[model samples]
Target chain A: MSMHIMSAYDEELKYLTRRISEMGGLAEQMVAESVRALVNSDLALAQKVISDDTVLDDAERQIGEKAIVTIAKRQPVAADLREIMGSIRIASDLERVGDLGKNTAKRVIAVAGSGIPRKLARGLEHLAELALVQLKEVLDVYASRSPEKANSIRERDEEIDAIYTSLFRELLTYMMEDPRNITPCTHLLFCAKNIERIGDHATNIAETIYYMATGAQPEGERPKDDNTSTLGSVND
Target chain B: MNIMSEAAVEKALDQKMNTVPYKMIGKDVSVYYGEKRALFDVNLNIRENTVTALIGPSGCGKSTFLRTLNRMNDTIENCRVTGKITLDTDDIYDPTIDVVELRARVGMVFQKPNPFPKSIYDNVSYGPRIHGLARTKADFDEIVETSLQKAGLWNEVKDRLQEPGTGLSGGQQQRLCIARAVAVSPEVILMDEPCSALDPIATAKVEELIHELRTNFTIVIVTHSMQQAARVSQRTAMFHLGNLVEENDTDKMFTNPDDQRTQDYIMGRFG
Candidate 1:
């Protein structure tokens, strides 16, 4: 790409970062209210979060269009070119994250009358908070170009993993203790897993931001032989 | 060649130039062969920054139209023009316009490499020195280097800037011509069938240079090769019988043109 075009791509990257930050704020709110709706059985707030998904979808569409126009007009190349393009990929992930939050909120409405047991509800709330914190941290790293912040998010993702493992074992133990608890316990386990997946997606966004700022794919141990390795694992 | 034909040519010579975007504009633009109308009534405005390729069968005024931008036609005998062809927003055809000054602001790389009988450094520096565009010798050196860099010729000639430009291969020589053109910082650069005399490799080199230069200078190229015109020019203006039949974006004009005549010409159904 020409120098003029690369600078234009930089402008597009800044615009995309702003849009993502706005979407991040919305996603954070959705997660908070979604857990609250679960704890308090507030079907209205849960429904509102589900219905507001169209806002995130609209933001995704706008960011996608901006990236497409940047590609068409500026013809970015190398790493500078990749940043504008990476926004589209990251925006798609953010949109999916929104969908996942909406799905969790919809689950709240599913069990509106009979919410999950209080103990399982606490685990879900804890998982949601851990995921939200990691997501917020990853976003901060992305916006500030801080590798230290990104590394901290990567470490904090392990906290979500620990919560997921505890929630999984707790649900399994509950099912083993009383077969009557199987249905709700399984639903709660899936909800916690959903939150865990949100943390994973946040990590993916962090890695992408690292690539955008530093032009290096996040350094880690090379994975074992997998023919599709270059394609990267989805939502990670 | 007869009286009726002479009067028709005279009438064509009388029409005023229309300077409009997407059209090559020339005013009272005239060319002569001891009193003959190569182009008449040639008032035209070639649209801004488009690759307006001049294509027609030989001696059909396409090449003459391309040359008039740099006043390359001025070298010919009895070639008299009484109007203007402004590029972007500047009137280039005014009589008071210095041909040297005009040539600097509107550069030309000819059908052949035609590098001056000098080193590659001299070949590029010739324009800057003649125009006095550089303030110091270092400034002149930087211009030569940057121009060559922009032309994609720097790497090949960097080790041998002092070597005669004529010693380079055909493609290198043409790139040197391009470098020479860029050194003067022209807003528009005219190419007159630049690849005609080069081998396929050299032709490709010139075409690549044209693509690269498009970002900087509005290029108007004359090409006998129809495919070359289709490949290089964003907008193609096909001239026939001393008239611009169609001027459209390259893809559209090649695939589907407004005039049946242009469609025929592009498809090789007619010239």
Candidate 2:
């Protein structure tokens, strides 16, 4: 870690880091709670996760403002500038993760009365577990300034995408076999996609952490196992 | 037809004079005052028609390096400079080389606006008059007007040509000094904290002038303000503890310095 001679400037940067950490923790909890709500068919917890998203949004706004103010006042260069810019970028990615969690929670509410299949819900839980681990590891990378840990998390994104792809096919198979499973399985597909997108946000944060630590973008294309194009549902 | 090897082609390209040719080259340059060494062996290349900024903490040999360009350190008693500094192909430190002519080719501005106690027109015309650059009254008038215009002070002081240069505002006085430097049509302009005494608006004006001046002359500036260096310079060199730490493109130096000492200095980490 680097420090400025001005203790107040250092304190402000520390506060900014703390705020981002808080937002990361909140985003992680929301993803877990949203997935837990879906598995247990608990509407109350899903609603709570959706309502708590505003806290992460507020934290992101605070970080953005502080970073801009610090940039304007300190005119920081090199690592200090990178640290402030990295905080702003990480907060933005975390806010989007919160939104994805909130979207998953809303899907949980949509499928509350319809009984979800144990095998399908279990698959999604596993997917969420992978995504949460990615988020947690990337956050740890940010806090510790470890490009190696960040690279490991980035490499694991393909695993989350592979799980998401397999889960997509399983849900599609279930829907085709029984039209009765269509409504609930479609909702599950969307929730699974939300979790997949959370993994993507985690990967983005990992890339940002790598840049902050090394002052260069991670070389080469990020590994991707997402084969959603085969489903004919990937617009991109 | 003979085929050139890739290495030979690259070597030829490197030797070719491009837009970024070195105007001044310092090789193994070192400075000493009395028995104490103030600067280590420093090698730097100042590109033609580009602004190169030297930045560091107090007594870090940035100013000393700046002085070495025009041999301004010669005024100091018991000061010694070793190694070579060449302007284009000519050795500037050769005993036979006229210091007056050398100073005329490489003019300097100081931290404070030290305009001569003369009228604005006289301040601008002094160099040309001494060098016999103007043959007639009209010629002297033209040199004064052109120099003032280049320094971005013609419009501000056009009507008050006879007014004492010292009576102008701090920023205007600095511009007058710059106009004085330009009067000689120097190949390079060395500014040592030219805007340090000015207010923000004046600093901005001088910075703007520096940008405009780059199209016509090579500029080397020594400044305490990193932002100013970033704003006005294409290349930046960082000095530390009498050693040249690093030099690179201005944007690269500020955003991602290769040297930890440069990073520390620019980041305000104990500089």
Candidate 3:
């Protein structure tokens, strides 16, 4: 039947999209500032990032409720339904990423006064920066539906792996020189790797967005530089 | 390949298994019976090997959408449908399309127990005979047996193939109609409230029949019962006031919907 096609329904869909975008924005900011806190060694900023996570978590719950309502009410199909399912999955990944950022911030609090070498700290900061760039860029790709940007994000993940390798090696050097540095350097290593994993999670979100928009999984693996050896344990 | 590569290949295969055939595709479809519009710009792909349930309140277009699948609405004068509806990838409404051939590929069982006024075997074989779907008497007998078996009626009706179809109870009659629809060897079957006329026991039988039919034919069913929709369909499409309110995997749509309207309807706040 040719009904009037109510504006109320249109407004509701727009509201759902807006709410999800709002949640996504909050999650992105949490990851960025959490990394910034690590780099600047600002204990207060790290604490603030941890405290603000409940807001993002709560946003996930809100968006989840809205998504359920949309599915019940709209009966969307094809591209529309794809986008909604993608958004639900993305919300889940975003929430998990939020928790990971909180964990990183808590690690910052733990390793605050360990007097780690300046060079090791620099390596950690570099890793954080690479991952943060990947997160922001992948999210931008999702918002714009730019498969080119998504492809680039997939490509950019290699830089994060490189930074993690560099961080791993530097931390190993610290442990080799001073047996006392083992505990703190190990914690720092995990912190850097956690940030790298967050980048990977963001890449997963990018892949879903690409699928939702284009109806295909992105092609090809990102180039991995073979020259880089594994960061070997000194025992080996 | 290494175990990791083998695992990835297996994962891809598992994904491929998740995709079944698409039985029906409606593109920009709008249906109107004279001045009354029953559906508006409805676009959907009914998946194969799955039961798809259309649910809505009275006058909400669920039945209209279901009838459109088999072009059952074509019988009503002044009923115009704009846009394409394809069954098994062939546009069913194309001018060159033979209505009989189309009906043979896509058969429908109406809301009530509408068994033909003929012997059980005759009712089941009517379509196949008219369409010449069977090549011989033995072929017709085999078709009837398979259809009756598929409809879960062979055990009761096999000895009474000569008995009149209308002599059966309402539930048995509905199953007979289902058997008749299946007799033509259709690629897809459309059911309009196939259980509406039956008792609870009969409804359960027909529902079980629908579940079994999914293995061979894509089935689209319309029901007023939300619980039935949830029970039967892999995917559920809900309609409200001639618009597709929401469609999704049945579980997700019922437990979690992306629209408030869908939520309200499923929760029984309003249609």
TM-score of chain B, per candidate?
A: 0.85, 0.93, 0.91
DockQ of each: 0.01, 0.53, 0.03
Candidate structures ordered by DockQ, highest first = 2, 3, 1
Candidate No. with top TM-score:
2
lDDT of candidate 2 over A184-221, digit per residue (tens): 89999999999999999999999999998888888778
Instruction: State which candidate, 2 or 3, has the greater lDDT.
Output: 2
Per-residue lDDT of model 3, residues B1-271, tens digit only: 5456755975675555357667788988899999989899998889888899888778989888887887888899999999898877688888899988888888898888888899999999999999888888899999999999999999998888999999999999999999999988888888888888788999999999999899888889998877788888888998889988888777667655666676656655432
B172: Cα error in model 2, Å: 0.3
Sorting all predicted structures by TM-score, with the top scorer first, yields 2, 3, 1
TM-score of each: 0.48, 0.95, 0.58
Q: Compared to the true structure, candidate 1 yields what TM-score? A: 0.48
Return whichever of 1 and 2 wins on TM-score: 2
Give model 2's TM-score versus the native structure. Answer: 0.95
Better of 1 and 2 by DockQ: 2
User: How accurate locally is residue A185 in candidate 1, as Cα lDDT from 0 to 100?
Assistant: 68
